[model samples]
Every structure is written in structure tokens, then in C-alpha cells.
Target: MTRLFTVPLAGAFALLLAAAGCGGSSTHDSTGDASVTIRIPDPGNEGLLALGKKDGSLAKALAVVHAKVAWTGSSGPFAPAAQELGADKLDVAQGSITSAIAALAQHPGFKLFAQIAPNKTGEGILVRKGSPIASVRDLAGRKVAVNKGGTAEYLLLKALASAGVPAGRVTRVYLNPAQTAPVFNSGQVDAWAVWSTYSIPEIASTGARFVATGGQIGSQNYSVWAVRNGFADAHPAVVQAFSRYLHDAGVRQAQNPASYVNVFTDAGPQAVSGTARRLTIQDLAQTAAPDGIRPSNVTDFDAVARFFAEQKITPTAVNVRPYVLSLTGSGS
Candidate 1:
């Protein structure tokens, strides 16, 4: 079995301290240890982090820097994980570009260091098989399930705008990730705005139809890895090592997609098929870039912030540069 540790989001802070060897010490100094805590959403499907954990590759890679990892499971959306990173309870966390931007607006202490491959194919607006909602424009006055304040909400807004639909025309039903499929299937919501892991499975099992995809709206949903500013400053080497590890993993998965897909099915629930897993992994690998955040990424993030502000999703526009860290020469 994989040696990754799983902790509930509520008790993550206390476990973070214990993982860092700060059990009895009052001093909050994290400079002396090479240990780090990373929080990943529960690997319900085969994400990169989940694949790495299942194969022992993630743990082995971290050991290269003599860094111990305390893996924590985030039960809900990326917002809570961002909160944990801001409170200094987590060294690193994974989130979407939209969520990361929103988090940075509130807590500039978090810096995006790297991004996973983009998977636009997995993101779309899903409707029941025979639902009358045939297109994004048809969503007016209908209820749509979105994980409010998350990638889903952003995608939905962008998709609607692309279809010439105003944001206020639809009823935005906020639901947790786990609640989306059931609610949509039960007719509680007219449609669901979701990405691959959730959207893919539901489409496969329930014969749902896609009204619009992220690709159709030119929305590139990139899953990103961000670290607390203080943590990155204190442990630059560890960050570099982890970045390389992730990049390498992306390459490996790209080369042998079947292997990673098998790992996911063998290690946990077989919710996704080998074909879907392979396509998702391929999309991630094809879009994987080097260690540092690119200028285009920053520009896109700023654009997302502006969109959020214009839609009243965010209270204000955020400047993304302040929360970006440069790992150019860090040997990543």
C-alpha cells in the first residue's frame, strides 16, 4: 500500500504540526526541518497526485531531498486547502487556476510555482440525455449546479458569456462536488457545470450530453501546484525537487498512460476507464511546462480575476504577480 498519510481538513493544522516535528515546541520555526505537508483533494479519480501516490513515486521523489511528506486529504473544494496554506498549516496544495487566483486575492501569502497539464476536454456543461437544454443559450432561467466559488462557477460564467447569455439569466445552484451528479440526475438542477473527474464519470454512466465544453469557450482549465510564500522561501530546494518530480511524472505518464491508469484502478475505486484515464493523462502531459510560472499564465490569471470582479463573483480585481514565485534558477 502507498505510505501517503490522509488527514481530515478540520484536523489538518494539528497534524501539520506533528508532521513537522513541532509536537512539543512552542517556536513556530520551520527552517530547520526538511519535512513538508501537502494537501491533495481525495483522489476519487486518477489525478496526477493520486497516480504518483499509488505507485510510491511521489514519496520516493520527496525522499531525494530528505524531505518527509505528510499527505492530507481535502474533502471538498480547493478553497479550504487554500485557507490551510494561508494559515501556514500546509506547505503545498493543488488547485485550479481560478481558485488559485481567488485565494491569492484574499491571501497573497500563497504563490503558484507550477501547473499541471491543461485538460479542457474534461470540462463542460452537462445536461440530462433528453433535457430541453440543448445549448448554453437555452440555460436562461434554468437552474445549474456549480460548486460555487470554484472552477465550475468560472467555467459556467465564461461558457454562458460565450453563448451571449447574461450571468443573471440563470439560477446558480451551489453544491459540493459530491452533490452535483446526484442533484443533476434527480432533476433538482437543470444542468451541471463541472470538469473531467466528475463530469466524465457522470457522462459515461448516465448518458449525459454536453452543451458546451471548456475548449468550445476557449477556457483552459489548468490545475496548479501552489506553495505558501514563507514555506517556499525557507525550503526552495524542496520546492525545486518536487517540481522536477512532478514534471518527470508527467512525462512518464505520457509515455505509458496504461501503466498509470492501471495503478489507479488497482489502488482504489475503478470509477474511470483506462481510455478516459489515458486521455486525461495525455492532456495533462501535453500541456505540462517547465518549473516556473509563465507570463501567459499570469496574464490568464489576471483575466480570470477581472472576470470574477465583473461578474461580482469577487469583490475586487487582483494583481497576480505579487503571489508568483520564480524558480528559474532553482535547479527544478
Candidate 2:
């Protein structure tokens, strides 16, 4: 019944609030005890957010200043979530700097308040094992599924370019991750340009191999938190406090992702078991260590923007320096 894009933005916002039992509260109380209830997307087996929610650590940390946390909307793509933030329907959500760039190109609503370094080792182009697609060169003239205008397309394009395959040669089938699965499994698409979530699981369980990892093919997607500008301006302390909570939780996950895997991946539909569980744990441990919420690096994002613009993913290049904000308070 709740459609994110089908209804007007205001209507969608109202629906989300009603669905989440939110009282449409946005601003902090005048006393500034951080009593404002922060609304964010429901964390669904999503790394540190899931970890924090499962243990009640996020709420406990926010309660220090009398702030409350509300989980609104289903965990989904960052594109719609970005729109929700812009409309003041939600206060915060997990996003990538690339997604933030794409959002800003369309409209203004949120500013990236914090950043996490990219872990591209596990995000790559997934292909059937022994499929004859030995390298990026083999992708030429083939259909590849990629979510347009973001990391998926970017990674694939970079891989193709590295191998000197003209963009026009390969047919890029624009499909979201959910839509791409069946087509990919049926061999309708030669490869799936996907993030670690799907890539890791598929590789561990299914007989899938990466034509090239993001690292090997040269692509970067930094994890970041985007906050509604209104909320950040109205309650700076709340933002800082919440960011600090996320940073600390990220630290714990980064330190030992294997230790937290039971809770982190437990909520998903399929239980990761056997060899899949072992391999997933290994990949997560390596990828998690180098990442945590941290300060924004404008230069790296500029590179991302330039690539998207060249690929015509964005209407034009977007300058992200203004939106790259550094809120106080984070873990060591």
C-alpha cells in the first residue's frame, strides 16, 4: 500500500510516517536535550546498522541526550531513500558518495554528513564459472545487467574501458538488483554488475566467478551517511550523537565481522550456511577492517562524479564539495 514513487512526495512522506507510527516530529525541542526522534530507514541485514539495531546499542546511545530513534520504511535502494530525505520524510539513511552525487544532480534535499572508505574487493561482475568470459574483453557484444546511474554501471563501464571495449559494443541491460537476479540466473544477462551483498552470496553458494573485482578493474564506491538538511540544521547535536553511534558500531563490525555475522546476516531470507558461511565471513572480515564512518574526501568523490558524467549517467558533472560535510564526533 505504501508506494515510494507512485504517489506525490508529500503523500509518500505521510504514508511512511503513518506506517512507522511517527507523529511527524522533525525539529528538536527548544531545550536542546536532543529530544527529537530521528527517523531513518529500517536496517535489514545491512552491516553496522543491522548490528546496532539488533543489540539496541544505537537507541541506547541516542538516549544519552534524550533523543529517540524511529525506523521507517523498508530497507531498499538509496535512490528512493534519497528522495525521502529530501522531502524531510526521513532524517538519515545509508548511501554511497556516488548515489549522493546522482541524487544531488536531480535535486537538493540531503547533505552527506559522513563517509566510510570503500571496500571494493567483494563487489564485482558476477559470471557463471567456466562461462568462457575470461576477461573484460569477452564482455563485448554481450548483455550485462547493471543498475544504471550508480556503482553497478560505473564498475562495468570501467572494466570495459580498461579492456578497451567500447561502451557501444556491449549491451548494458539496465536493471535493478532485484530485477536482475532471474535474468542473470537464466543466463539472459552474461554478467551482473553487483555489490558485495549479492556478489558474495552468489559466489559462495552458486557457481559464479568474478570477471573482475572492482579493485582489479579499478572502481571506487565509498559508503556514506546522508542526512536531511533540515534535520541537520535543526539538530546538529542529534546528528553528531547519531553519527558517533554509527561510527562506534562500525568499529566493532570492522574489528571482527565474523563475530557479528550471526546477527548481521541472520535477518535475511536465506540463511548463509556451510562453505558459503565460511567464505562470506572471510570476505566480510577483510572488507570491514578498512572501513568505518569517517571524514569526507572531496577529491575521491569528484573522480566518481567525473566518471558518471562521462558515462552520461548524470545530466552533467555535479560538484560534491558543498554537500561533503564533516559532523563532529566519531570513533577512534
Of the candidates shown, which would achieve the greatest TM-score relative to the real structure?
Answer: 2
Candidate 1: Cα lDDT at 193: 89
Candidate 2: residue 304 lDDT (0-100): 89
Residue runs of model 2 more than 4 Å from their true location after superposition: 1-34, 264-270, 288-296, 328-332
Candidate 1 stretches with Cα past 4 Å from truth are: 1-45, 74-76, 262-291, 329-332
lDDT tens digits by residue: candidate 1, 77-148:
678888888787777877788888777767766888876555667788989999998789999999999987
TM-score of 1: 0.81
| Error at 28, model 1, angstroms | 20
Candidate 2: C-alpha lDDT = 0.72
Best by lDDT: 2
Cα lDDT of all candidates, in order? 0.70, 0.72
Q: After superposition, how far is residue 111 of candidate 2 from its true place, in Å?
A: 0.4
Instruction: State the weakest 10-residue window (summed lDDT) of model 1.
Output: 1-10
Clashing pairs in 1: none
Error of 2 at 16 (Å): 30
Shift in Å, residue 4, candidate 2? 35
Count of clashes, each model = 0, 0
